[model samples]
Target: MAELPLADYARTLTGDIQTLAEAEDGSIPRTFTRWALEQLEESGFVSNMTVAYHSGHGVMVYGFGYSDDRSVLDLYTTAFSLDPMVDRLTKADVTRHYRRLLAFLQKAGSIRGNFDQPTEVHQLCEGVEKLLSNASKVRLFLFSNCESAARTQPEPTEFQGLPVEHHLWDLARLYRHQTSGAASEPIVVQFDPPINCLSVQSVEPNLSVTLAVVPGRHLAELYEEHRTRLLELNVRAFLQARSTVNRGIRLTLLNEPGRFLTYNNGITATATAAEFVEDAEGRRVGIRSLTGLQIVNGGQTTATLHHVFKRDKKDLDGVSVQMKLTLMGSDDLMAIVPSISRYSNTQNKVTLVDLSANDKFHVEFERVSRTLWAPPTTPGGPQTRWFYERARGSYAVEEAKQQTSIVARRKFKAENPAAQRFAKSDLAKFVNAWSGLPHLVSRGAQKSFAAFQANVKEQPPVIDADYCRRTIAMGILFKEVDKVAKAHDAGSHKALITAYTTARLCEETGRRIDLDRIWREQQVSDAIVQAAHDLCPLIMDMVIQEGKHVTEWAKSSKCWEEVSRIPWTVPEELAEELLARPVEFAVDTREEEEEQLSRLKQIELSEWEMLADWARETRALELAEQQIATTIAAKLATNATITAAQVRKALEVYDNAIEEGFSAFAP
Candidate 1:
């Protein structure tokens, strides 16, 4: 079924939202869940009544709701309520509901929202992070569109950029880890090692980054058409432009590909050069050149501004720019970054980038700011520095003012150490403001037992039973069982709960393998439930990577593992990492016999697979002649006339006999 159109959700629940949100704290009950959900109709949100599972808190029952056109903004979160040892909701409860709902939503899509919740308060933000991780599960669920004979679906991607090669790097790292004491090791490995991808870069003057799609990461079904559209409509145009150049003169341009090309960031094009010389008035402003390289459409000239991404193409022609760019290449070269240039894109988003100069691809820009005192540093150096400079130039006081937003800090780090420390150190004040909780925590827990013991020793004698009892409360003793399981059968990082789920989801849904059976057969079924554990960050990754094409999340950590591995190398045949092979020898005697029999049968079956019907008929004729001789000999009560000698003589006129081709055994 199609995903619930976000529009309808709003239309149905218009005024009723306050009832859902403002219900007397925890007043909503299971009975009301269904009624509220009926209002949702096609919305993918599940209700508390729909789920019955064990959660960190206790046995959890959940009900869900979502916004559609009713959302007014044309977007709203998929709402959910949890009945974990209770009924109804609160802010914290809703947040937890959102976390879980986000997990399920991510099972098929992408999600957007700040990790607004404090990380130190609890694992809520972390859970949200895990919930939002490599969210290909929802992506896979959306693969339903691919199964449709009606419309072609988009290809899967690491987010939506980072082509297969870029993905390959991540994949390489994943497979390296998976095969090297991570996931199940494979026997064969093929790779182009030590390769770095310049898939991500921040644009100059803006600090807006361009994230390239990982090659092969996007399944052909997810956004193949978009990519194809970019290629056929955008990439093709660039290629066509380059091909049109008379002799060494080359040119290609796009007024602006809107939205898609623009994406989460506004900048759209990148340029590079063999050498960029910031020449002009003594003032060293910025790279400036002639603006408005117009395009003639139906005899009407359309003004289009281009940014130079790479400059090494064709002698790195032109001058008057303050920055001298020479030998402009991909991100690997220090001369450039992977980012989009602004204003150049007014026509379209999701535009295909024009690539030129066999070895280099960059943005095309105009000369204007020839003096800024800053020389173009490679990759994102210029833009990052410029952003800081730009901020100080425009709003020094406001920029310097104390800010509490996490998103702000993430995007723009403060130059001053005091500003940097404000988030971590000042947080205690906010934490203490709460009445019940005592002391605060950092973003990370101790990685080792000694560290944990040290933390315990420092705590006051009066411990919060709530904290220590959480272990017995949840019944999830990860540390102890892990060691026991390791002693028995030690291969699994069983800790990476999400990847296992991803592997299973891929297997079960892809019809490639059965994961449940494997789980049951393994010694540690509890260990395998790591799916939801890793869910948070993976979903976050999906949203970060995708930006908007997909937004909304659900499912557990296990699902994200698949998304995380998108860039890594998994052999099509083996379906595991294609690097660092470590093999295990297994001898199943009965299985070996069965395999040998299958091989033999296959050889016999090849008789038909390899031969034409007439050759079979010719053999039949030879059999009939031998039978006829045998019949005549029986009538005469003597030796058969068609003896082996006679049959051999008749068949060997040319002396060369036809032999069956040998069949090779398939693994």
Candidate 2:
């Protein structure tokens, strides 16, 4: 086994031979440099590549990167050591130039994500790879680099110690537009990596609430589980260059959970909880480890905490973790935490453990759940509490020793394990039912949206949601469908699907939600809404037009466009059911063909003309039927007595009557 370094494994698999060898030395040869330039041709990475030469052999090149709107950043210098004008410069100056250029480049989207899979550049992201000894410390490795014009003489730009410029760019853009002529603006652009953003923060005291979490992704499997979205960065020099990476926002969450205290009026926060003596024999029970104080309110209803930053919800999984929550405070005040004595409504102890103020407690639970909601309207009539933390301290940090000191413990026989008989009063069941709402809706909507996509011939069908929203004049939602569908991020695509589904569902109920004017509500971002509205109508129009052309030969020419625009006159769902049967088009049946062929033979051209003339004349009482007595035309669909043969026979009768009159004249 190679037993390569953890990060280098990726570089070894997909990296170029020349690039990999010199990646340690931080240089690229001409051949690989040329390769890098061509890889990003279709990608919106570089605008133009130009080369200049000095003193006949010395060469210099400058790359200019532009944003979509064509705003220019400073020069992106690749390797100028070959250029004669810059060749005389000291190594120190070259390094400074590269660093300065990096800073400037980051001002745009100048982060090297993955050098290996050049094709997936826009679809991926790269971060740092750190192995911090934290309960939630993470390491992300997005391997990427860029090369200039020289084909065989360059190494991709890399980071041995640098700041993540893309995030910086995003932050700056977010701020620049938000502030209109604010004094806080900085003039000469200076990018210092790890720039700290300052804001006011407050920490509230420990409050009690019941919480339950369902296990999810393992921390180490962040990218493995979300490989579809993660941009695989070059891990080649990650170990040597770890200093240049940003693991993510760092913060500590302090938690101390106490019991819910109850009084006659209602339940409230507990100030303290009493501790119990250790008993090894008889009824065994497990107690919450060292609990006197808890963080958060007892009746925490509906709360959602997304990451403060736009960190991928999945990257959070990469955080290696050891969570810690502690219970430490005055023993006297702790008695108030689980006070069944003072707050019990009935004499039979207490249904819920009561809490008193001023008790400190802690837990070693990692908060990995994406968003937690504890609603007051819990289904089981129990309140729930939940929190989302960015970073947490190590649970192995001397917290295991504190586990012995717990408050009142619940006990039951092995035959009837207390866990087996948790009541509606228990906290676990309450949270499960309440917190499942969003996911439940999303899962259902996913199925419906997929079905619609399969049926729609258009590349991206207008979200059924947009249709409803448009009906109600919500122009923004009507517009966002297309944007989300083609977004580089799959999450965004899924979210777009969900949004469209919800909008459609809402419309089906006659909610009067206008999608065309969805911008009025401002529920979604402007870009997303515009993308949907602008793209959907064109797709619909195209599908309709194409359908018109295709079905023109099959349908009557005059009605072809109408048929195409309306597509199927019958409902789509019903069409499937109808198609399942064995079909027999009446026009194609052999029996019908024979009848049409036989009828054609009876109508001769002379007879046809003679019959036509007689029918036109009103004075032709001289037995017009006598002119066409041998006809054998088909009968009417509901022929009571009218057949082509009967008409001919009647004409013969008229001729006989005329003959009889002539004979009487001769007599």
Candidate 3:
């Protein structure tokens, strides 16, 4: 699809920001910054970000955070224009913004003492001072709602002897990022001197493998440049010397540099494309460049090498590590990379749940979201569905596909409003908060998602139609309470307030908030909103009284414990309306079971056969379970009557097959 014109896109974006700001009772810049940060976090451009706007004395910042490993520090600022027609941000404007952000970093120590009463800004300055003391690199980002007129980025410089990099995300750039439908902008690495490698021809088209030895110094430099982006596909983050493997890597790097190559299980990496240099006989000998390089395995070795090089000041002169590279096309990256990551890891265990977006639970949730029509808020009004974006850009992609017809696009938007769309991380946040995990929600999206996934792995939930409706209800409730928190105080830490308030409400009300009613009405009642408002300040006071950085304090389970201990009861009127017990919307078990069985029956017989064969081959099921699957497939082939018990057993076997890496036949 062709890109939208800059002016048109800007107007649309402004409309979105306005809608969001109005909903949250916030300003344009804060809303825009929060929105952009969500996108960046989703794309792995940043992680564990905290939105805290502070501007004064020729300094300004909207957010701050560290890389997952704390090797790089990031600060964010915005150059938003109220005028929708505004098209270009000049180089002078860009420089001023960059300098303002830099000044915040430079003067954090001095300005930290200026605030007599602790504020979010003061907390941010304190965080900056502490994190910067050991940071090896810093990044300053300027997010603008206008296209940048500057053609070239500022050269990398140093702040307090640490390297500083500048990045600008102008409107045009953000537009591409939203529509590109890729995880993140590709990371292209160019080698000054081509390195030798041995290539193996693969039978599969557009797939090749190669083996190469890379110098330890070069590996460290690459990690410094890319940070966690190189490990995007890897399930686990850098353990940072806590694990025996990392400690051993550090010890070897410091004690025996030469044997590092043999001692390490060489990294397994994937690239969208690779440039090769040929020898005199026309044989591919060296690799000159790699595009979209992602390390599927050996992230610990890579991270530990960089850690020793930077923190321990160990020499990497004789250190060399082997690497296995798989080259494929860009179209195949998402489809093929996760399998490689899941199987290649030798140092750590990677579970199916860690794959997250592709897990069966999410797939089932997405399916329910597509098929279930939410009741119209008013009689004779059009019904809509809450769009569950299981993948990053699925909503945009679906919207783009309808652009060929104006009516189709209009219908699509009416049915799936932009405000109703939520991503997987958003679901994680809402559910975690309601499940009395405000501390985990406070840890930011990626970490919270990791925690949520681990919990699900331990205690899996059935993702059914009723579950989907109730999940959307929780989202609606959280958002309404978010407005209450913002109206109480529009500054930083509103997310923490909303999370704690909802969690406390659940605790105080005994999880009897009538979610079925909320789902049917498509919003929370006035009493719940009032209850949230009543709890907001109390939660805020508890958070501030902890005498810790608000972000840091909110991340502690102890904070939740203290907040839960606060004496707050639901108002009498709200309590009288609360359900005696949580309501189950699916009242007709027979009909629900019939619906499920119908869905299973809709799957082709060949697909069921394929599933059975896979389960038998992988030994994912017990012998009895395998026989059950085979029986179901045979019954389907013969149009035989299948019992409800058999159907349940078939589903269990199917789920087991999915958990065992079977995806050839997904129902």
Candidate 4:
């Protein structure tokens, strides 16, 4: 497929931004920043970014983030123009934005005290100061709506003795990223002195494997340069100090560096291409470079080694680790990479749901979405379908496929409008809110999807036509509530308000909010919209009154508990429209109870005793709940039969403990 011209793409992007801003009642800069960040995150360029726009005193910042291990800090800013025709960004413009971001870091201490009370800006300034204290490197990203005319980036400089790198993502670069159809920009690694390796035989024409022993120092340097990009395909984040595996690796590095190769299971990696050197006998013997390299397994080992090398200043002179590198073409990456990632980590605790984009549930849901059309709101209006993009950019791919004919493209879009398209994370957020998990939804897309995936794994819901209808209804309700929330306050805590409102509505109505009616009508009622507007302020007040960072507070389960306790009632008009949940939609309580009991019984008596003791020590549970935990532990010790009510109470206590920040596997 041919790429769109840069000028045309820019105009198209401008239209998209305008449409999004209008829908959310937000500013252009805010909408563009959010949209760009989402794209970057999906491409593995960034992760877990907190969007907090603050600008004043010759300083500006859209958001900030840090590496999972706190070794690298990221600050982002935007240079947006109102004119789509303005297509070039000068070097001076880039430097000015860089200085604005640097000024934020340099003056964070004094800027933090400028606010009388803690606000988002003040919290961000304080966070910057704290994260920088231990950071070894800082990255300043400048996102522009125009293309950069310069071909070279600014050289790396130092900030507070830490190296600072600059990255520019202009329109031309973003356009390529969107059209390239790759998950992330290809990473090209060149070896100064080529390392020796042995090629393995493979039956597939497009597949090749190489076995090599990589120096520990070289591996550490690579990790420091790429950070989490190397582990993007890995199932889990770096486990850090809490993981026993990491601890063992650390010990081996400290005491027995020479034995590291013998103790470690090594890493499995994949690449699009590998350059090899052949010996006199025409045998491939060494690797000179690798393109699009990604670590599919052994993330914990790689991260731990990097940590020890940087933080402890350990000498890796005798340390060496094994590597299995698989080479394949870009055409095979999307089809085969997930399987490689999934199978490589099978022996570990990684679940199939961790890489859930290709899961059967989502596949079935996408099938239903494509085949099932919503009833038209008007009697004679055209019926439309909700496009569920199972993968990122699938909607665009489908539209591009029909681009040979203008009429065909128009018909494709009219039947499945861009406004009605949703992605996996969107479905997770909508369903989680309706399922009484607004806290999880507020935790950000990656974590929220993880929680949602766990629930789906536990229950394994059947994705039928009825299920898809109800899911789409939840999406409609969320969008309606979001529109009302954003209209009232465009800049502050709109997501929280929308999520909490939907969850509260579900609780107050006892899960009888007439979702079927919403599905059939293809819109929310005015009464519910009004209810959302009325409830948003109260939710905001509750969230802010706690004097904590709004994002952090919303992630806490206590936030939901307190908001659920608020003395509010649904409007009478909406109350009359509520319908009892259909019998077909009801879960089998007996089966669910049995599952819960089975899971609880799997826990060891000692673990239960420890949980009870810790709960009492932390005061996480009330006296009655603490006593029940103790009773359950005792019963387990004696092999005594526990009643169904006790099992229910024990399960509640476990959940509450988790909410209180208790971790069963914390070191």
Candidate 5:
């Protein structure tokens, strides 16, 4: 096995650092903090989270500790990178960090400006106090690029008797993680005897599930101890945004405590491993401790229960929560965790991309990407490879470990010609660019990515080898156009320029040239290259007419969308303006010229009708027509919208849709 050098490993672990020593400069602490978080999220310890730097009271990174309903961070957390910033990371430094954290927590209740607290700290003080006041346990994570040592004070379970948990992500732990990408050890919790009674049975090899009726208080305590780490990443990603669901769950608990269990579907949770306290006859009496506890579903319900108990001071004396806890080997857990999260909460319309991290399609794509290589760019040169990271951290792990046991850790990036590598989002842009809808390509990456995913699910054939080749060619063309445009000082309108130019050129070339053949040859034609170089100035002029302010016009994707709807007559109009002056790829004969004109006119006619239909339906026709005529002296045109019948066929192909359609809203 090839061992990755520290520099390569560090680069893989943290994109910003080049060498292990670089991490010593206060960078590794923050980088490792993120890496540990990724491990936590992947291991079902926490949900997908965005850390806000400089938000947590001079802390480097701060956000909600948990993913479910308890999103508010009561645990005032921070990290100190011990490099040049500090000569040594001693117990004293750790103590001061915690002291600063406690001092902030103590004054969190009142936002009074007694002393000059940073705006971030003052703003969060009141909310932190409220979350902590109702909190069963608060946790402070002190991440550092330093060795772990004895604490100045005994590492107490409680801070001033408030049940505070301390977690240290020190340099040694980080070093092991960086080298091997090992998982964070699961937090184990022992169940009290007679724990609401349960039945257990093996479901698969190394997998057993227990069915039980757990008390609301028991569930609340568990969530409090683990916070958001209890929820699976998908559930957290779905529920992290503040919503009215929290209030609704709280109201139900306070007003109709008896109906809460019935109203809520309870929780589907998992554990990496489990132990049972058995009776004399070997009957399972109670669960001793569950390692790596994670709630795959019902995050909202758990958080709501915790919120009601903590914030409202309400007693859950008679409340109970239905629990389905599955115990599986850590290896098995990785394979099916996302699937569990996907099907667990049918009530929420979770976006497919969020649910698609472990999706077979992505897996297959990664396989194809790694296996396929472009022919050597020069004779005897090594064939170039494309890396596709189906899951996060795949590249670093692969480089360091040279393995693919974890689907989520595979990388999809190539070392040379870095721009050739495509992430899922970039793949979406490439696909959209060639789907007879370059307008979608110009809309922006996020929108394009969502659209592309819908296409993938609705159209599996969209990702075959031929399609991948075309996407690579499109990337090549896009990059070249961008390079050419920048050379001519095109500025912000560069993308807009590249997009329309490609669309119209593709339209023109299709009449005489076979587009598929170009991709099949894996070669960008000289004519196309020439066209891209020649078209930059002309497209810039068109953009100026449509948008006087180059900056605003360049940034306006919405404007580009409107412009693309037009029939794009500029190519033909420019040709006509130079008709007498022999154009390089001009129609050589009368019949050929007529044929090209006929196709353009046909396209223009259809575009006018489509524009009119779209305009009549949405009143955008007038605006589209105005932009087109003003910019290129053409009518707005668009590809026909997908018909309902076609959509039905797609649904049938995928076998998806609500089997039993119900009313739009429950009465």
Candidate 6:
């Protein structure tokens, strides 16, 4: 939690990494790699394919798979020069790196190897071929922590006759993300000489709505430049949607070309700002730049355009499509952009929770937590503060304002439990850990998020005081276990420490201790803390023993994923092993929590009875019964058994009653 210079922080992080490397246990590097990849996955760089292993091809790490946008992803990560003066990455350096990797790609079919084979480069090559053959295009991403003075991009190349483009995720790019609290980089779209467009100011302040007819060539060119960055979070949904090629759109682009506008419903986009050049007569209509452009709608159309242009060598000179652009600068726009995207899509079925960064339920928790602080463990101890980041950039902004004292910033982070920094993905990881699904937990952030969203969709739990408190309590338990594990050091096996904390430590400790009661009391008991200190050492030993089966254990993402798969079942074999050993508690506390809740439910039922009776007895309720029943019936139809007649009756009288109440029943 200490606030050091940015360079110092990087040094410390990499220094710990160096120690992790020398320790040669594969825990630290594997753990750090997972954290960085998860951060990237959350930011929209990688998609469902997060698993990576060291290939020993002069590359530190490599992963090849399908990205969220349905593009072929061949990602390679390596450290860049930490020296501040090294401002630019040379083209020669990148070319040589790929050339070394090319040996594997050249013979993709010969890549059969065991899971932990040292020649994992062969598997990576096989992935590249699978993606290239099936995907519309292949993209290569190179990540580095070194700051680039300017945008240093890679030239496009070909693999097995498939189109491939290169993208650089350098340190300056990451620093910008750190300051802005953004996950993905903003894409700047320049429209030279003022294309055909119309602009109108929105009723909402600082928002402008514009409609423009963009040439197919220009659209294709933009996609070529930015690739999946333009798709935003919807990239996953876009890929998952029907793969039925838009044959009609493709044919039109290849054949008629001119009638493309009539056939296509143009894309709807959102941009942060618009730059315009005034005409000689000072007419402010010439647009020079469109910053932070994201294609919220019409993804399929744009992708189809690019695909046909490349595949069929179609002429796009006469092909143009309509585009609706929303320009807004308010931070609040981040919340609503997903809503706009959901409604604008005529093609795909979008899930509400998946569309936005975090839904209203998450934001409400942030709002509530900021108002209350958890009770300290000791009677007079300072209450542990809870900080919830509803927006990504707030933490950095808060730190910058406290520049005078590094201790003040460190105190802020210490007070704020790491678990309380719950974004949508973080919440998913927590819930999965508790749900007894170590496989889902091991699947990394995006997969965990999808699984969690699916769980919510199946049974929407009430996000009330108890739920929020318990969620925070779960976070407290996980973080506390982590602290205990780290303090023990476990021979610098931080990954094992992290893995055990989430997979076993939290689940076991949670089951044995009364978490709900602890949440209600607002503090962790020393009994649980001592239990973690006692249990972690044994768990670490088991993990280390399991890890010895593989060579280069700490070197690959696969090693961590493999370790994460170990069963964390309670009162089972592993639990029995631990219970047989000297430990603090050997009982499950959920039974006691359930007994208390059963009594509380009876009290709640009595309260509901009074409210139900009041509703039936009040004449005012009978007077508005038609409208109220209609509203209830409409909602009930979504998930409940309702007849067509009942639905029609509810709809038929509801509107007429409202109309009559306004005029016939007017006072």
Top-scoring candidate (TM-score)? 3
Encode model 2's per-residue lDDT on 265-315: one tens digit a residue.
211222133222224662212222222222212111100011211222433
Model 4, 1-667: lDDT tens digits are 5445667567667776777778767778878888887777655566556667888888999988776566788999988877756657888889989999999998888888986443667767766787799899999998877888778889999997999999999987887777765666888988768888999868999799999888888898988888666776665642221112378899999999999999998899889888898999988899999999988888888888888889899868899989999998877765676677767774566653244456676887899878899898899999999999886656666766776887986797688876688887789899899988998787666656667766776677767788889999999999998887767652446677788888887777777788888999999988888778777777777866534656667778999999999888988888888875631353325567787889889988877888888888989889999998899999998989888789999989988888988776877
TM-score of 4: 0.79
Flag regions of model 3 displaced more than 4 Å.
Answer: 1-5, 238-245, 353-360, 378-382, 401-414, 454-462, 567-571, 582-667
Give per-residue CA lDDT, model 1, range 1-667, as digits (tens).
1121222222212222334334312223322332333222211121111211112332122322111111101001222223211222333433343344334333322212322322111222223233334312221111000011222223433323222110011112212221221111211211122111122223543222222221111111212212111111122222121112121111322222222222222112222321112237432222222111111110001101111111112222221111111112333322222122112334344222222111111010001111112222344433221111111111222232323465553343332211111111112211121111111111111011112222322332222222212211111222223233223221111222222223322332232322222222322233333322333243234423322221122222323444545443323433431123321122224433454434433423233232223234345335544343334334234432334443343333212213332222322
**What count of clashes does model 2 give?**
93
Given candidate 6, what's the lDDT at residue 263?
82
RMSD of each: 29.3, 32.2, 7.8, 11.5, 15.9, 11.0
Against the true structure, what is each candidate's TM-score?
0.17, 0.17, 0.83, 0.79, 0.52, 0.63
Stronger candidate by TM-score (2 vs 5): 5
Cα deviation at 294, candidate 3, in Å, is: 0.9
Q: Give candidate 6's whole-model lDDT.
A: 0.57
Query: Which candidate comes out best when scored by lDDT?
Result: 3
Query: Can you list the residue pairs that collide in candidate 4?
Result: none
Please report, in order, the local distance difference test score of every candidate based on alpha carbons: 0.24, 0.25, 0.81, 0.79, 0.53, 0.57
**How would you encode candidate 3's per-residue C-alpha lDDT over 1-667 as one tens digit per residue?**
5455566567667777887788767778988999999888866787667788888989999989777566789999998887746457888989999999999998888888887445767777877887898788999988888888999889998998999999999988888887776667888988779888999889999999999988888888888887767776666752221212378888889999989888888789889988999989978899899999988788888888888888788769999989999999977776787688777776556763244467766888899879889899999999998999987767766776776887987898899877888998899888888789998888777666766776665566667877898889999999988888877763577888888888899888988998888999999998898888888888888986535767778888999999999988899879988999954433224545696699779877887889888777878778998898899999998989988888877887877777888786355
- Which runs in model 1 stand beyond 4 Å of their true positions? 1-524, 544-667
CA RMSD (A), model 5: 15.9
Supply candidate 4's per-residue lDDT for 75.
Answer: 95
lDDT of 5 by residue, 457-507 (tens): 554543456545555666666655656665665533445566656655554
Preferred candidate (lDDT higher): 2 or 3 = 3
Worst 10 residues of 2 by lDDT: 234-243
Higher lDDT: candidate 3 or 6?
3
Residue-level lDDT of model 6, residues 217-268, one tens digit each, is: 9998777555556776453433332223478889888888889899888898
Q: How do all the candidates rank in terms of lDDT, highest first?
A: 3, 4, 6, 5, 2, 1
